[model samples]
Target: MSPKNLNVVAVAYDRLSFFEFGIAVEVFGLPRPDINPWYRFATCTAESGPVGTLAGISLQIDRGLKTLDRAGTIIIPGWRNIDERPPERLLRALRRAHDRGARVMSLCSGAFVLAAAGLLDGRAATTHWRYAERLQRDYPDTQVDPKVLYIDGGSILTAAGSAAGIDLCLHLVRRDFGAEIANQVARRLVVPPHRDGGQAQFIDRPVTKCEDTRLTSLLQWLQAHLTAEHSVESMAERTSMSSRTFARRFREQTGTTPAKWLTFER
Candidate 1:
């Protein structure tokens, strides 16, 4: 029930991205004597010793899978490959952690590992947008939400992209401790205290009129009048084009449907 009582372990592996793993270490692994008196950190690996990173760097992980037993919270930073199958032992370990009430999290491509373990089946989860389609194609039973930054399913959690991991981790801190303690952690980490994942990852800037004055003007006008109810027929009238023609042109210029784009801008 207390923040200091948490024992956190970050699962690492060979040929992993140091940055993704760093997020766990930065949030839970590192010593924070100022925040709590009982927070502990450890790195768990399938194999002991140094592991290779994407950038030819190596990280030292002295503890093996045995480290998992002591962890109240277990984080899977990432897996090496999605296509390759995860080891049964690792999957069993994760399932046991879940069964024992240990909180588990997967960051970015780490969702693939959880999927392989069959823990994410029939659950709403997310991974990097680049792999969203593939994840859906591979795991039909799971509801893959490519929109939100992360999904917190009580015991299990998954993050979308790299940076989104920070959001999810901070959210966990807020949930476990409180806004004040989470804010303290955020201030120490120099990150935002809170960010609604529903917020757009990247703001869509209005297109410049120099390239296509007509379409750009139409987009600008639509954005300016988002509060006003506008339909395809209404927009077609304003653009002075047939509804079908306007829809086709909108897709060709923006690579998205008019309705979807409007919702995003709104």
Candidate 2:
């Protein structure tokens, strides 16, 4: 059986991160002549000539945004600056490709670009947890979920920062091909075959909101007392409430069941 042919385009921008761009090229743009009989890759810029990478290196791209026309999948490796506006041409190309059923992906803060193009509005999406709140604040129409490593919303996908890009790209390959082919590709690259999207983003600092003062107090108490066997009954007693009332309030305040919350606390 022959492997399916795929034209993967990695869109480059001025001040793009070299490491991020390299991740895309290594997976999509590299010549895999020995392993696959059919996959094509290209690095494209919004314009011709040299573009600077975040690592202070420059690369020459022969193709431009026009290449997206022939691509089966389009990827934005990473955004230059989350606060800055994406070039109008890039946004237009991405929007049009997505409209035509081409799979579109954004890695790291690249989700910002997709959100700017209105591709993520009303769809569940994720970015590096550090920018999740900012993404939500900037794009009120989008549904941002910060907990997961990636979100695959059919034609559109968003991945967290750094290594999670690898996870998302491999996931794409798996979806396009199958587990066996995807695993073979992963073995050649020496990367894991699969990482469930449910994996935690592993933020350096966890955010504790101030809205739930009592809950926060309870949480602190739980953290300080994890050594002791804790239960809903004990938690209710600490707050001077019945177990049923405590469980209900805990769910409402935290948006999770007590069991799941305990897992987090643990």
Candidate 3:
């Protein structure tokens, strides 16, 4: 459905996945003046009161299930468990939203929630590769493709994993606003405007290096000068440290090799 009102409401619940939630909040929730008539983002819960994160931290959610009724776009971040079913009322609300022509989306394991709701039956969908088989098995009618970063089935969308959620959200931006506006959002977020949905789920993700003050300072500089050539030796020299030590510390701090980090930074 083409909605002139870009009101996006994300569902938040107990054991809320922080990163996936952040993706929605960052993309839709943030104000983007560059794109006039920006999205109106809010959060809703199945029940009221504070919701806890998977790590047991408390999160205060904004509205209740009724809010889904008003949302032009409804996003389910990451479902906490594939083994357990989402609340029946939540499923009903989703179904109601979809029936009324609201766009519905999921991130990571949140696809399982849609599957449980029977929204994904006979539809192309995806999720974090680790849970792909289970999602397919649980909902035999849905076509689950594990390799892609996300899937766009018009009204229903699903993203593969944490970072992939960003891609999915941007895709929504492109669809709703336009390519130029979406690219502007990507530039502000410091991410690519698009990563094809078929991109591999897992790549060589390097271990994060310790984010000491030195590395923090260095990263800020790297972001400002992505075109500048960088190497272990060059970085080490700049930091006034030996190359070997610099390499080790870099991995510990950034969680990836210097080469990989520089490539992404650029």
Best by TM-score: 1
RMSD score of candidate 2 (Å): 6.9
- Reference-based lDDT, residue 21, model 1: 88
Off by over 4 Å in 3: 203-266
TM-score of candidate 1 against the unseen true structure: 0.77
Q: lDDT of model 2 at residue 103? A: 84
lDDT (tens digit, per residue) of candidate 2 on 1-266: 43343888899988988877787887776777666554688878896579988788888888988899888788887798888989899899999988877888999999999999989989989998889999999998888989898889988999988899988988887887778877877887899999988898883433444365777798888778776777889888888889998888887777776677666667
lDDT tens string, model 3, 1-266?
33576899999999899888988999999877766788899999996689998766898877899998889999998998888899999999999999998999999999999998889998999999999999988899999999999899999999998899999999988888778888998998999998888888876655444557777777778778889778788888877789998888888777778898887655
Q: Which ten residues in a row have the lowest lDDT in candidate 3?
A: 202-211
Give the TM-score comparing model 2 with the true structure, all chains together.
0.74
RMSD to native for every prediction?
5.1, 6.9, 8.2
Top lDDT prediction, candidate number = 3
TM-score of each: 0.77, 0.74, 0.75
What's the true lDDT of residue 59 in model 3? 82
**Candidate 1 overall lDDT versus native:** 0.82
Estimate every model's Cα lDDT from 0 to 1: 0.82, 0.83, 0.88
Error at 64, model 3, angstroms: 0.6
